[model samples]
Target: MTVDRRPGGVLELRGVAGGYGGATVVRDLDLTVGSGEALAVLGASGSGKTTVLRMIAGLHPVSAGRILVDGRRVDPLPAQHRGIGLVPQQGALFPHLSVAKNVGFGLVPVDPLARWRSRRERAARVREVLDLVGLADRADDRPSRLSGGQQQRVALARALAPGSGLILLDEPFSALDAALRGRVRAEVSALLAESGATSVLVTHDRA
Candidate 1:
């Protein structure tokens, strides 16, 4: 696979803390992920691993601390404007959309330069990321037609289509079978490295 280089993938979380209503599940979390690096946050169920990712992705409010991407504080921005990609558990591919459309969702309106303003540009980008994920042949298929692992790849392609600097994966491979889960996780890790996107994977799996 050909690698594409881009600027601004560094991620930093300083004294980050958050939780539901009155309780704090995560507190004082500080970490930095340089461009092209992958960090795994391992925890058991209900251990606040997903909360950390949500805080960074801006889905959950941060009760304390700051989140920065390439030295820019993104905690203040909305989820779509944060320039961070997220692959949630079970892939979360839309059943109504084709693989190509699923991957192209983020490329629309999220790019600061509006580089994918045209349909042709967006299609090309979707195809490029699909190829990266080895799903070029399944572009026309619906999410329901794909296997669990393929759906996860499509979810990843969606997250990557906009070329987000940092990727947050919340147990993305949990729905796959044991054998498939290992294979997909390795492929995802390699793809993130090749793409040079800083990544944080929160999962119960230690392997």
Candidate 2:
């Protein structure tokens, strides 16, 4: 399956289809997100919105079709090797780790033989993202100590820490209360725009 490359295309899903055994949730989907653009997939609950994101993030296998990032095929690659960031529905932070440490987790080299970044460099990157998320003051606190909105921000910081060109957000604001959801949604929209990342966000909410 070949997709004519679109100029500035950062994320592309061509004829993508996937689902659990014997049940096709996403079928022949085609989508493209340009550089620094944000695409939202909105649907009712159980509508297979997150499945599209997982397929692109390499968390869920694509039964058919191609996933491309920056013009390169990424469906064949491991999740970590795809050079894409994913913010799962839950913040998925480590309760035992400090906010700063959780955000810095991606900065650590996965391969023992790979060159590790300097502690200062990693710390600086963590701090940079924490500031962007307005959580710099909470850096030393654990995820358990923060509010739901705050934890989500930490997750966003962690996802951005690696500076991935494409980010997949799976209902990032769903956990927040009604009062806080809108605020966090706006903040996230602004932050994504400021970061200049190509992002795909899936949610049940129309707002």
Best by lDDT: 1
Task: Report the number of the highest-TM-score candidate.
Answer: 1
> Candidate 1's C-alpha lDDT?
0.87
TM-score of 1: 0.94
Q: For each candidate, what TM-score against the reference?
A: 0.94, 0.91
The stretch of ten residues in a row with the least summed lDDT in candidate 2 is 1-10
How far residue 173's Cα lies from its native spot in candidate 2, in Å, is 1.3
Clashes of each: 0, 0
Candidate 1: segments with Cα more than 4 A from true spot: 1-3, 110-112
Clashing pairs in 1: none
**CA lDDT, every model vs. true structure:** 0.87, 0.84
